[model samples]
Target chain A: MNIVENFDLFAPRLINKKELLSGGHRACSGCGEVLAVRLMCKALGENTVIASATGCMEIVTSMYPTTAWEVPWIHVAFENAAAVASGVEAGLKALRRKGKIADCDIKVVGMAGDGGTMDIGMQALSGAMERGHDMLFVCFDNEAYMNTGIQRSSGTPMGASTTTAPAGKVSMGQKTWKKNMAEIMVAHNVPYVATACPSYPLDFIRKVEKAKKVKGPSYIHCFSVCPTGWRCPSDQTISLGRLAVETGIFPLYEVENGKYKLSAEMPKKLRPIKEYYKSQGRYRHLGEDEIKMIQDRVNKEYKKLLNKVQCLEAWS
Target chain B: MAKRVGMEVALAVAEAVGQCNIDMAAVYPITPQSHIGEHLSDLVADGKIDAEFVTVESEHSAISAIIGASGTGARVYTATSSQGLMLMHEILPIASAMRLPLVMGIANRAVSGPLNILNDHSDIMPQRDSGWISIFVENGQEAIDVSIQAFKIAEHKDVNLPVCVNIDGFQLTHMVEPVEFPDQELVDKFLPPRVPFASLHPSNPVTMGAFAMSDYFTEILKAKDEALKNSKKTILAVWDEWAKMFGRTYKPVETYKADGAEILLLTMGSMGETAEIAIDELRAKGMAVGLVKLRLWRPFPFAEIKEVLKKAKKVLVTDRAVSFGGPGGPVCGEIKAALYNEAERPAIYSYIIGLGGRDVTVGDFTSMIDKVNREEVNTDTYEFLGVRE
Candidate 1:
C-alpha cells in the first residue's frame, strides 16, 4: 500500500506513453500475455534491452523480416533468457566502464513463458539471480504450454485437463499443483520478487517499474490468462485474470528485499475458487469434491500469504 | 617486444586471450580447460584485465552468456572441453548464425563413454558444422598465437563470425613449453576494438534470432553458410597480419617436409609435431614421407588440402575421432570429401589412431606408414592402428 499510495493512477500520470512493443505482433486475439508484455514494456521505457526466451512471446513478436519490438530485443533460445540477460547486463556494464559504448545504465530484461520459466528455464533463472546480475526476469504464466498447443506445463493447476493430462476414466487431470515460481526466485535471495496480473494494470505497472529499478536481480511472475489454452471465452480474458486474483488463487503481492506486502487492491474478502474455475472449460470435469479440494488449497495458500505480510520479516 | 617464456600451454593461451582487451568472458571449467578459465578469472580479479568474468553454472549457460554479451557489442570469450563442449553444442550454431563476433577456446578432449578426459578430437568433431571458424594448434606457441589471432578473425568486419581455437587437451594444454606472447601495444595495433556489424543498444534497436518459417529458413541458413565460406578470406588476411607483426607465420594448411615426397602423412593438432619427427626418421632411411597439418577446420581449406596432396602418390590421413558406421574418422572423412573428384588425386588412406588419448608416439606413426607400404590400405573405411584385439 505504501508503494502504491503516492501515485495517482489516472492523473497526468506516470507510466510512459511510448509503446516499446509496437503493433503488428502476431499474437492471437484475446491474448493476456501480450497485453502484460505491452504493460511491462511501457514501464520499462526506452532505456531497456530485452532477452526473450523461445515461446509465444518470442515467436509472435519476432518473425525475421518484421519485428513488433521497438526496443533492443534478442531471442536466444528456449530456456536461457535469464542467462542471456545476465550476459547482456554484464556486457553493457563492461562496455560502459571501458568507454566502448556511451556511459549509461540500461535496464536488461528477460521474458519467458510458463514452460520456459517453471520447467526448462528454472536453472538459468536461478543462476542469474544467484549471480546477482542487475536484470529483471518476467515469466508470463498462461498455465500451460500454449504456444506448443495446450499441453500440460509445470504451471498448470491440479484438476485442470490438458491435452497431455486429459481427464480419463481412471485418472484425474494435471495431478500436481502449479509451481510457485515467485517463491523459488525469492529463495535465490534476489532483491525483488512479485506476482502480477495485467487485469490490475496500475499495480502491475508499479511492480514492473520497481523491478526495473532493482539494483540486483528481480523477478515478476505474471499470471496471464490464456483464452485459447484454457478453453474460455476470448472476451473474458481480462475478467478471468481479475477473477483469479480476486479469489486468492493468484494473489497480487510483492516481496521487496525479502519483505512481503499485499497490493493495495488485494480484495478484503476473497471470492470462492468455484467462481474462478467456472469461466474456464479446462476444469469442467471437476466434481464437487474436486472443487472443494481446490477451494481449501486456495484458502490455505492465501492464509499463508497473509501470515508472510504480517511478519514483514526481511531476510538478513 | 615479443616476450618469450616457458609457460603451461593452457595458462599461456589464457595469457594471450587476456591481452586481446576483451570485455567479457563466461567460463564453465572442465578437464584441461580449467587452467585456461582459472587464469582468465584471476586476470580479471587481479585487475590485470578489465573484463566481466562470469563463472556460469554449466557450459550451456556459459556459451549462452557470451552470446548475450556479444549481442550487446562486447568482445567476448569462453573455454570448455569434453562434456562441457557437448553441453554447448546446441548454442554454438546460434552464436554463429546471429553473427556475434565472439571468440572461444576448445581444449580438445575425448567425449566420454569409458570416461576418458585426455586429448582427442571427438569433442570438436561433432561441432564442425556449427559454422564456427575453427583452428587447430600444434604446440604451446601456436596455441597462444592462434588464441590471440582468433579475436581478430572473429571481429573482422567482413567475417563477423564466432571463432573457436582448438588446442589439444594435455598434449598441448598441459605441456610446459616456451611461448612468445605478442606485446600488448602491437596486439592493440593489430586487433582493434570490435565494431559490431549489428549490436543490441538503446540508440539502435534491432531484433536478433528471429523465428524463420520454411519460406525464409533455407535462405537465412544459406546466407549464414556463405558468410562462413567467405570468412576464409578474412581469416587469411588476419593470419597474414599476425605473421607480419609477430614474425611467426601461420597457414590454413601447413606442411612439414612434404615437398617431392611420395607419401604425405596428414595430421591435426599437437600430433603434427610428433608426426613430423616420424617423417624425418623415415626420410633418413630413404623413405619419401612428409606431413600436412590442417590449421583451419571450417571453411575447410579445400584448396590448400588439394594443393598439399597434389603430387603425392599416397595420402595417409590420421584421425583422432571416429565417425562410427559412417566415414570412420570425421577428419579423414572431411579430407576424403575434399579430395573427391580430383583429376589426379592421391590414394588417401584413413588410419584412425590415438583415440581417447592412446599416445601416438613416433613408433605408431612409423608403423602406420609401414602398413601403408606393404599393402594398399582400404580407402572406403578407416583402420584403427594398434587395436588391442
Candidate 2:
C-alpha cells in the first residue's frame, strides 16, 4: 500500500494567506504546544472556531486587542473548552437552519492543556462528548501545569519531578501514574479518538483530518513536549517527542468507532526507556529502581495495547 | 390580544423564552430549574421552537456552551438552581465581559451545608458582582414577563450584557399559577433577530475574552463597570416599552401603599408577595406600614431605593440570606451603603428571614414589625425571623 499517497489524500493544503494561526505570538522558543496548535489549525483551515481554555496557549495567542488567530476564537474560563465548543456547534447549526448564516461546513475545536483537560476540564469534556456534539476536542498534554509555573498535573507521569512534587530525600517525584486520557475518551464511545505527536506531522495532520470528517464528537490527544517545564534544552523538543514514542512511553494510535488501530508501528526491540527519561531534567532524579518500574509499566501497557489492536484485526 | 393561561411557573418561563425565538438553549438539570430545561427540550423536540436544545451534563458545561453559542451570534438560554448556579459562577463574569447577551433563569435555592435545595436568596446574592443584569420575580406573571424582557434588555445595543432572572425555587418555580402569554406577533415585534455586537464568524474573525495586562486591565474593568451601570437606562427603557405593548407596568423598586406611611418594609423575590399581604393586614389594624418590593437587584436601583425609603420614618429590610458576621443582610447592607451619605435617612432595621425554605407567615411579619416598632430588636445586628434558636 502507498501509505504516503493515502496520507496526501487526507492532507490539508497549507496556504500562507489562509494561515489560521499567525506567527509573532508570545510563546517561548521551541514551545511544543504552539507548534502542535499551528499544525492543528492548518488542518482545520479557515472554516473553524476554536474555544481555548485559559492556559499558556490562550494567554500567548491572545493578549488584549492583538490576536494570533486568523479564524474566530474564544477563550472562556478554564475547564469549559469542550462546553464552549458544544455551544459553538449548536449555535452554528441553529443559524444555518434559520438562514441567518450560509450552510457552510464549520468545525468547532476545543483546545486545552493537560491540567485543563485531565483535572479541571474533565467534566465539560465528558459532557460534550456524551451529548455527541459535532466538534473536535484536542488536549495538548505537556505532562504538567506549565502555564501556572510547572505544578504537577494528573497527566504528569509517575516519578517525574515537578515544582509541586519535588525530588527530595524522602520524595521520589510524582507519586501517581499518568491518567490514560485517550482510553478514558474512548470509554465515552465517541465516534473518533486518536493519539498523535507533533514530532510526526503527517500522523497528527491525518488524525485531525479524520476527526474533522467524523459526524459526531472526536477527541485528539496530542503529545506536546514542554522544553521549559521539562527542564530540557529548547532544541531537543521535537527529538524528545520522537523519543517518547520510540521508547514505547507514548504510542501513536487511533480508535475509530471503537475499533483500535496502531498508526505508528513499534520496533520489535523497543529502545530503552532511559533514553527518553535521561534526556529531560524533570526525570533526572529518578533512581535505578524507579526507571525499572517505569520501564515495566510502559512495556506492560504497550503489550496490552498491541493485543487489543491484534484482536480487532482478527475480527475484521 | 394576550391570553391568560394556568401553568407551572418554570414551564411558563420556558414557553416565554421559546416565544422570544431564541436560536439555542443549553441546559443541565437541577432541582426546581429542571422543569424549564425539560420544557424547552420538549418544545424543540415537538418542533414548536426552531432552536437547538443541548442537554449538557453539568451547570458549568451548560453555561459554557451557551457562551459559545451566544458568541456565535445565536440567542441562547439556560437555567440553574443554587448549587448549579454556583457551578456556573466562574464563567458568569466572562459572559458579561464578552457581552454575549445570554439569558439565564436562576431558580433561587439555599446554598448547601446542610445540603438544602429549597428557596433562599443565597444563590443570587453571590452573583451580584458578576456584571450581569439581575432581576427578581414576585410571581408567575413576573417570571414569564421578566424572562421575556431579559432577552430584550440583554440584547439591547446599549446594554450588551448578560441577564439573569431570579425566581424563588420551589416557592415560585414549582408553583402553578395564572400567567399571560403574549401573542407571538407581539413578541416577534418586541424582540427581533439578535444583532450580535461582535460575534465569532469565519468571514469576520474577532478574538473574544482576551487576556489583559496591568496597563489595560483596570481600564478594561472600568469599561465593564461603566457598561453595567449604563445598562440601567436600557433596562428601564425596555420595561417602559414592554408596559406600552403588554399593559403590564414594572418598576425598579415597586411600592405598595407607601403614601403617608410611618413604617415601611422591603423585600425581594417571592417574599415581596407575602410582605404585601402583611402590609394589608397591618393596614386593617390601622398600623402606618407599607411594603417596597425590589425587582432590580444588580446595578441596584440606588436612586429609586433612596427616593422611596426617604419618606418613611423607619424602614425594616427583610433578607433571605445571611452576610455571616458582616453588617446585617446583603440587601440591607447595600441599602445602608446607598443611603449612608444622604442628609436625612430613615432609621434602618435589618431582618433575616425565610432561610432554607422556612415558612414566614403574615403573623411573623406583623410581629416583626411590632418588635421593631417597640424598639425590641438588637440595634447592632440583624434579627433572624424564624430561627428556632
Give the top-scoring candidate (lDDT): 2
Model 1 per-residue lDDT tens digits across residues B222-295: 98999999999988888888778888899999999989989889998999989989999999999988899988
List ranges where model 2 is wrong by over 4 Å: A1-17
Candidate 2 Cα deviation (angstroms), residue B358: 1.3
Each candidate's TM vs. the true structure? 0.98, 0.97
User: What is candidate 1's CA lDDT for residue B115?
Assistant: 94
The DockQ for candidate 1, computed on C-alphas, is 0.88
lDDT of 1 by residue, A163-211 (tens): 9999889767999998898989889988899999999888899899999
Q: Could you give the CAPRI-style class of model 1?
A: high
Give the i-RMS of model 2 in Å. 0.7
Q: Against the true two-chain complex, what DockQ does each candidate achieve?
A: 0.88, 0.88
